[model samples]
Target: MNKKLIICALITFISLPNLADDETTLSGAELINNNCARCHNSRPVREFSISEWRVIMPHMREKAHLTGSEVKAILEFMEIASSPAQPVEVTLAKSLTVNPRDVLTRYGCQGCHQVQGAGGTLGPSLDNVISEKGRAFFLRKVKEPQFNNSSSAMPQMPITDDELEALAEFLSSI
Candidate 1:
């Protein structure tokens, strides 16, 4: 009986798509097609962040019989796919845990400040700042606008210190 059970178990394990010899580095679309499509139809992968996916993947993993490697590959694929596609801001090889342009858009910087010779006329254009000034100047201006210029009309942004640094870095590149 034990011999029979072992043979059956091996057969079942071999049948599972999550077996070690199966495809390991699946892309986001491939993962969805193979694992997620087993139960539900296509759903928007961009609807959730990687963190939210982390919270939700466990429930689906058990249901789908996904291995740990499969779950990790899928999560990475989704994170990269959902990230804003910008040459300077992102590359698929690097996980997009920190996208500066996303932060800039979130803070509505382009509403007033201009970059690359295009933006609202409300604030001064930042196109020349990188060439004329430096990163230090850019950082100070973003973190504490009034410090850079006492007569500056730009308001001090409510962004966190890291966000301010990222914004400064992005602007400096522009």
Candidate 2:
């Protein structure tokens, strides 16, 4: 009876899959692919921080309709499989100027600004303001808002002058 009990216990232990160490947990990449890759490719690992991941995961879960366990698996895979981050060139910040339309797209300027009477009414219509206001007034308003009209809810956009000028030009053209 004692020998049979020992054998049964040994068989059960051998049959069970051993989990990896608690510190360095193994991830299920196939589970991630099946669940995540259905909607969007795995974003570059460098593009997101842990905090960003936490924020984005819920939105992605809604998008992909992923369960809690699936999301955990995917996050684990990302944490374990993350490669060493590449050094971003600091000079790129000084050299690069984002296009005005891209800025508008990124910041959702049209959500408020009415270029040629097409955008939202939250703020003053930007239509013909480029031509009407002239470049100086436009630059000044963009760089330094003289007044935050209590009625108007315009968020100060963080950008450079060249970008502002480009935005002015883009708005005027529209």
Q: What tens digits encode model 2's per-residue C-alpha lDDT throughout 1-174?
A: 556556766766655444354332344466556766666687565578766777788788877787787677767666655644434332223224457668777767789777566678876787777687787777777665645354445666787766776787677677
Worst 10 residues of 1 by lDDT: 87-96
Compute each candidate's TM-score over C-alphas.
0.41, 0.40
Candidate closest to the true structure, highest TM-score = 1
Pairs in clash, predicted candidate 2: none
Cα miss at 75, model 1 (Å)?
33
Q: What tens digits encode model 1's per-residue C-alpha lDDT throughout 105-145? A: 78787788777765677887777776687777877777788
**Given candidate 1, what's the lDDT at residue 94?**
20
Over 4 Å off in model 2, which ranges?
1-97, 148-152
lDDT of each: 0.70, 0.65
TM-score of 1: 0.41
